[model samples]
Target: MPDKYEAELPDEVHELLAAADKDREIRLTRAATAENLKFLELVRSKVKDVPLFWAVTLLSHPELGQAASSTSDKEVFKYLTDVELVQDAHDPREYEIVFHFKENPYFTNTELRKKYSLPNGTKPAPADGTITDEMRAFEAIDLEPSSMTIEWKADNDLIAKHPRKLNSEDDEIIDGDIGSFFHFFTEKSDIMSLGGTIIDVLAEPLEFFANDPSGFDSDFDEEDEEDEGSIDLGDDDDEDEPQRKKQKKERCCHP
Candidate 1:
């Protein structure tokens, strides 16, 4: 267990926690690795940035605007790739998000990707010789802001209004205190604090989920499966919530 929060977590978060715990063992078995890799390929092909963008959108709300600095993003990302957990002041939901992102693999620039080419293909070889199919490499995720561009879903229903009046004399001077969400993205684009934002906003929906998780158990499995890939929150489970919580074998990521 990676220290449960003092606050009760959402069921989906619980499901995620349970899975993360078992992943350490699952990664050691070659059979598990092959199955999980299939699932990962399925997800990487079908769900590219669903988690990343959804996480950011959840944070962009007035109450959940991210405060973590870019350095925090960098450090947290290091922890994420290493499958370790660290205390985060900016987001209480750090434990949950980090475990979820554990599958994000090591990626590189054009030069490095070129250096490790796989046999005849342009694709890079495994990150290192030790890299095996059992490794949880969610390499499809492009965390670098410069390498990725996002198209926000139309803002019609997505807008969040400010809860506090920016009445200070220099309120206009403060960048974050300004009036628009699009502007915030534009300003933060250069700094690469986008990762921090992804980490921070997770709390918003999670807090919402901690209460309901909007029925996440159906999509996630309690028993480690050979072909499981990733979290698909929309799916529904047959077991009632209380019973699902009792299972210890629940796995987190396919990898």
Candidate 2:
């Protein structure tokens, strides 16, 4: 037997070390536990619909508590995968995610990592980048419409008082129709002043008047001309006389 002590010690130590190394490898492969999966899933679900820039902002930077608090690690992973945020790489553990700013789409790896605040351990590698003229033009344009219409109505008294002049205070008066003096008084109030009475009556729902389409249509046709002529019943008597006479003559001759 040639050095039996040396042979035994060397074989035993080597075998033991080999077993430990195998166990360590197994543990490293299983590092992403169920808890990690759950967290990633939650983060993914929350940020899936959010913009890519926002998603990256939340996931890459742990300092933004607002983004981190709302999501879990599982959700983050899921969103990353779903959005194809991570690209294929030689190392399965590593990922490549790209962010594009349309106007200046070209970005270096260092710039992107710095701007996005990537994790300390993460390694970013830039591919190709381009900024099309179409993209630049779209970014420069304001897409919102210049004007919009809102349905509204004016108080009859206000309309009556400023018959000749458009209502300065409420330029958005889309409709102005109140019934005759008797109807206004009987249904609305005993206010003798035409302006005040008309306003009060007009404030009430026109359900009764609106219910009969034929009657409403006929009245609308008759009053449409009056409205077009800018004749307000509450206007000064002297100023309204000529307009009233002209309207009367038109009704008699035209009818």
Find the candidate with the highest lDDT and give its number.
1
lDDT of 1 by residue, 1-255 (tens): 767657788999997776675444434443533443354345335534333322333322323222211222222222121111232222111121122333222222111000111123223324343433333332313222222222322432111322212436533434443233222322313232323433333323323222212222323332244333222222133221111112222212211
Report the C-alpha displacement of residue 237, candidate 2, in angstroms.
62
lDDT of each: 0.29, 0.25
TM-scores vs. true structure, each candidate: 0.22, 0.20
RMSD of each: 19.1, 32.9
The deviation in Å at residue 254 for candidate 2 is 92
- Candidate 2, residue 182: Cα displacement in angstroms equals 78
User: Which is the leading candidate under TM-score?
Assistant: 1
lDDT for model 1: 0.29
Q: Over all chains combined, what TM-score does candidate 2 have?
A: 0.20
Cα displacement (Å) at residue 177, model 2: 74
Error of 1 at 69 (Å): 19
- After superposition, the stretches of candidate 2 with alpha carbons farther than 4 Å from their true spots are 1-11, 31-38, 49-255
**What tens-digit string does per-residue lDDT give for candidate 2 at 29-140?**
3343233334444644664553332333222221221112221221222222232223122111222222222221111111121011223433433233232222222210
